[model samples]
Target: MYAALTSLHWVYLLFIILIIGVMVLRRDTTLVCIIGIFLLGLIATSSLTTALTGVFSSLIYAITQLLGTILVISIIVSLSHIMTHTGINEVMISPFTRLIKTPNHAFWIIGLLMMVVSFFFWPSPAIALLGVVLLPVALRVGLPALGAAIAMNLFGHGIALSGDYVIQGAPKLTADAAGIPVDQVIQASIPLVIVMGLVTTITAFIFMKRDMKRGILTVTSTDLQHFDEQMNQRKAPLSKGLRLFFAVLIPILLILDVVGMIIFHLQGGDATALIGGTIIFILMAISLTAYKNKGLEKITDYLINGFQFGFKVFGPVIPIAAFFYMGDAGFIDVFGKTLPAHSQGIVNDLGNALAHIAPVNTEVATATLTVVGVITGLDGSGFSGISLAGSIAHLFSATLGEGIATLTALGQLAGIWVGGGTLVPWALIPAAAICNVDAFELARRNLIPVIFGLIVTTIVAMFLV
Candidate 1:
């Protein structure tokens, strides 16, 4: 049953507005979000003490909800780090280098290779792996470094991270906030990810081809020299047999995991567990064999570094997530007895009220959610605003009466594609730095294609749901 909107509900709405306002100004909303939580709790319980405790309680609650995602990402990053040290990562990508005989070939190979590697180890590390090995090949074959960067940004960050099929961190965050299972979010994202990836990447390739025809897309001599110097200076040694073993073993193992997921009907936590377990064994086996005497110590070191990276990424997200969680019914457990009996989630109530007063049509809802997702992405972390996207998608779905999964997936693609790395100059640093291009310029080059991608994907989503 839906409860009537209360003063607390109105206050919650104001805070949401303020949070968005702060994000628009490109400022961190963590403090604003914490204040919002405190004030909302104070109004709800009419107790300063409860409000103060609720701040910490809500953060702990958010962390609890997201711990699984954080852990999985951390462990995967750890395994990736070990792979790099053992030189297995290089082995994995060596085959792709042979295909880069032309600029057009370079573009597709680099983009596809980056996308596949990023799906497993994430885009940041994938950039490091691909940039060193493949970038020079692309440049030598006539593809500009800028084109390579754009391809990596669109394919890796826009495609892989948006869907996050392997790691599932993004979907886990969105699904938890939306009160849905992680698998549902993943399944919903499949079509949307495909559409976004194709539209943005293809549009970018066309623009790149046109630029090349005008003689404006050539890699400069200075950049090529710089890249050559960097490449010569960075080489790590590993046994040939070991490299080949992992190069072949890793993909087969990961593929089997995917096959298992299909055959056993595994999804969500079960699917993630399978992936995580495989990585653990891989990490252990590699560390032991690669560093016989120091393997045990190295494993601990990798795990520590991985978790540090993982929590660091989620740090800003915690407060933002805490604020949004307060708007969900599930957070009642976090607040103990503070919430009133029969209380509805703030977001849910707002959705119900809107549905009753001025019901949103499917097109309007899709456009509005996409806009909201983009706005939330302005903070540039790509993740800070995802909880809000999930919450709002849940609300929109309730009002629209269908396509909850599709709408949530659409919001995820919008938020991640914009803020994850493409539109945000700051988030574009990894791809930009590796390619030796200006982050702002990369973002600028990415703007048109990404926007077109979002528009096309949203339209396609309207049909699917």
Candidate 2:
């Protein structure tokens, strides 16, 4: 009876349904499932008395647990917004535009930089920064906004997220679930991730090259005006000295942060803090240097815009993250103590059920992991479904003989790389919104390259792993 009833975490299953319904039929509002989770979890506790107490308690619990991750994301996003409005971000991008002279260069560079930044910071925030700065230049060099956007989505969200080297998020969780060193998973995934990256990059470029020639293609000014308006404000320009200051200082500071992260060994949220603090200082320096008399007010007002930008980009995802987080053992420890110690949480139960039905052979496990990833990605947010997948991987790693972590990472890659935003209209909306492209069209454009990449990655994983 326990095995039968627990096969589906009723509340979590409800959250999934809630998310799908909201995305397909409802639309507009952010995180309807979170509210549903509160109500549903409350009612599951039994009586009206338990429902009343559990609802508020669960809400608080979810918020408290997710706060650190959320706050770091919010601050980084805020810093990115601050830099953009202040023109410091523009000054920063001015240098990159000088280098990427061709469409191929633009595609690879945008994809590469987004991967590097997003490895440290999550992709959603990083995409806004990359899109605002490098995206236009990519377009100017004859790359379609669709191509640039696709690059951002794939590298930033896919390869970077699967490895999660700096943040070590997916790796750490998988390692913990499998009871292995985080470093072990990291080491194992290096070659597999690189193979996937190469295959995906080549495929995406091939798809994008259909429109642009080897040299350059021209687009109408109206079709591409959004890129220019990125740093344009109706406000006044800066003085020569102030412009010179940002020109000289910003790169030095960013370089210092990069060097420090390497030397001091920053990981997880610490890396985000390092980048966020540096950006704030950069924001301050520019505000003061540009507007000496009004520096304080400008700084304060500018930061508000930054917060808005951060929230606008990531706000919807927080509730979604919160909802999915409930599927993890981390959050369950606190609110779910009512269950017996011997009882399993959502992740374990699902994994145990899977492992029991299907023995953990190499071929079976690899395919299972990849299929799980694809399924998880259906609701979008490739990262959302990973913790659950990680948990399942943990259960099977012991029984599956060799290469469980590799299978796990591959599974995670499929789910997020596709669902997170690369090929999904709902997930791609943010990138599409600022890039001024239609999300559905972008999804259609991305489908072929992305699918080809996935097939290649899956095949490679089977042989190699």
Taking all chains together, each candidate's TM-score versus the true structure is: 0.95, 0.76
Clashes in each model (backbone N, CA, C under 3 Å)?
A: 0, 1
Q: Residues 298-417, candidate 1: write the lDDT tens digits.
A: 889999998998898889999998888888854576566544445567787788888998968889878877887898889888999988888888888778888778888888889999
What is each predicted model's overall lDDT from 0 to 1?
0.86, 0.64
lDDT value, residue 154 of candidate 1: 94
RMSD of candidate 1 to true structure, Å: 1.8
Model 2 regions more than 4 Å off:
1-52, 119-141, 161-164, 167-189, 213-218, 224-237, 247-255, 258-262, 291-294, 297-332, 336-346, 349-357, 398-404, 462-465
Task: Name the lDDT value of residue 463 in candidate 1.
Answer: 87
TM-score, candidate number 2: 0.76
Off by over 4 Å in 1: 338-344
Please, what are the lDDT tens digits per residue for candidate 2 over residues 315-386?
A: 454455444555555345434534434446554555555566776666666676676666667666655455
TM-score of 1: 0.95
The window of 10 residues in a row where model 2 has the poorest summed lDDT is: 1-10
